[model samples]
Target: MPMDWEAEFVFRAILIGVGATATMDIWAVVMKRAFGVPSLNYGFVGRWLGHMRHGQFAHESIAEAPPIAGEQIIGWSAHYVIGVIFAGLFLFVLGVDWARDPTLLPAVLFGIVTVSAPFFVMQPGMGLGFAAAKAPKSNIARLRSLIAHTSFGFGLFLATWSAAQVFQI
Candidate 1:
């Protein structure tokens, strides 16, 4: 049987995306604080932004504050919106059948594209020089971020598909 199109599901999917990404950021924070590793926490993107006036580079190492209350809020919002968009695209391609197929290719593509927004605006503002591309030692960090985002896309497809089934929508 063909599945029904659902605006509500799509919206929820976006919400899920936002929640999931926020989870990623939170994990990142825990990793940094617990281990003293300077990993990219959720606030990493936005906080670097706070330093723009001083010509601080995004890739430059700096002290980290305890996770800010605000960054998580904004970061989660961004994640949800991006997730909604990806689910929308999947809906467009697979129609209601996205619940069935949920191809990884399109999801990954959507993620790569979504990443460009931060790369263009936040990265430069934070002094990372074009999505953290401008760092003298940016290659690894850039690749890692890319991989993480792609993983996010994959997670979206899996979660949405699974949710669709579990909800029996």
Candidate 2:
């Protein structure tokens, strides 16, 4: 039977998403253990999302906000779902050929672009201010965010390449 292109893209995109997210998570752990830098807790992510319900799109400090039940679950789920969405976007924008040949630059560029979410939307909404300007170590935070996103780009590349190899797609 001939394979369906739609099914292949969806399946591979999901695999790539999981791989990329895993890579990002691993990088976060390594940074924390090796450099004493901390990663954002998903609980804060949950809190931020939860409050988005009451028309509260922004906060002064998500950590200082009231906790919501299942915030942790919500945050973690959002993290993974966002990853899958990014993977889908990558595939949609670059097409399946990119996945088959797997270039690093495009993947990395996409990863950097994704950082805008945190720099603009997430950071400000979380009350860290734009680009984390309100944070004590704003520059450091910005750099870390860059590095993390860059790592995610690499993750996307590796994931897509691996998937292509495994599925021969």
Candidate 3:
């Protein structure tokens, strides 16, 4: 029974992460097609990670940085991996009980908290300046990021609910 519980727990966490990430990606596509507001390309994320190997932690312009091999693959892979990691964190902090019952507030807060990585670490490292302050209409970019992250929170909750339904929990 313990082994079964552990397996279910691991499976559910991965499902939640993947489902939430898929939701976030869908939101990004909608934002791009509907608003003509482009989000940062994951290719750039790959580029940044690639550059990090050379000790280049910050870039003046990530776009201008020389392209790295397999950047798109690297970036996309990392994005999903990060999502899974966050989901794992959520499970770790809240425990198996939360996974069974689920709650909105915690999921939402976790999503919002996830923004710190991009806002402080990824944005600055990518040379977009703090919270994308250097981007055109920086406020808009920041707002979009917040909205997107919040959406991710919703995704997490939705995924958890879906899982609960499947397990009939």
Which is the leading candidate under lDDT? 2
Collision pairs in model 3: none
* Lowest-sum lDDT 10-residue window in model 2: 1-10
- Tell me the lDDT of model 1 at 65: 29
Which regions of candidate 2 deviate over 4 angstroms? none
Query: Which residue pairs come into collision in candidate 2?
Result: none
Over 4 Å off, model 1: 1-6, 15-38, 47-69, 89-94
Model 1 clash tally, residue pairs: 2
> Number of backbone collisions per candidate, in order?
2, 0, 0
How would you encode candidate 1's per-residue C-alpha lDDT over 1-169 as one tens digit per residue? Answer: 6343576556546654654455445555665699664655446544554444456644434234233347655554555566566656655665655655566676667666666766776656555678677666788667656765666666666666666666655
Q: What are the TM-scores, per candidate, against the unseen true structure?
A: 0.62, 0.95, 0.92
Per-residue CA lDDT of model 2 for 18-123, tens digit only, reads: 8998899899999999988899799899999999999998998898999989999999889888988899999999998788889899998999999998999999
Please report the TM-score between candidate 3 and the true structure: 0.92
The candidate that wins on TM-score is: 2
Residue 63 CA displacement from its true place in model 2, Å: 0.8
Candidate 1's TM-score reads 0.62
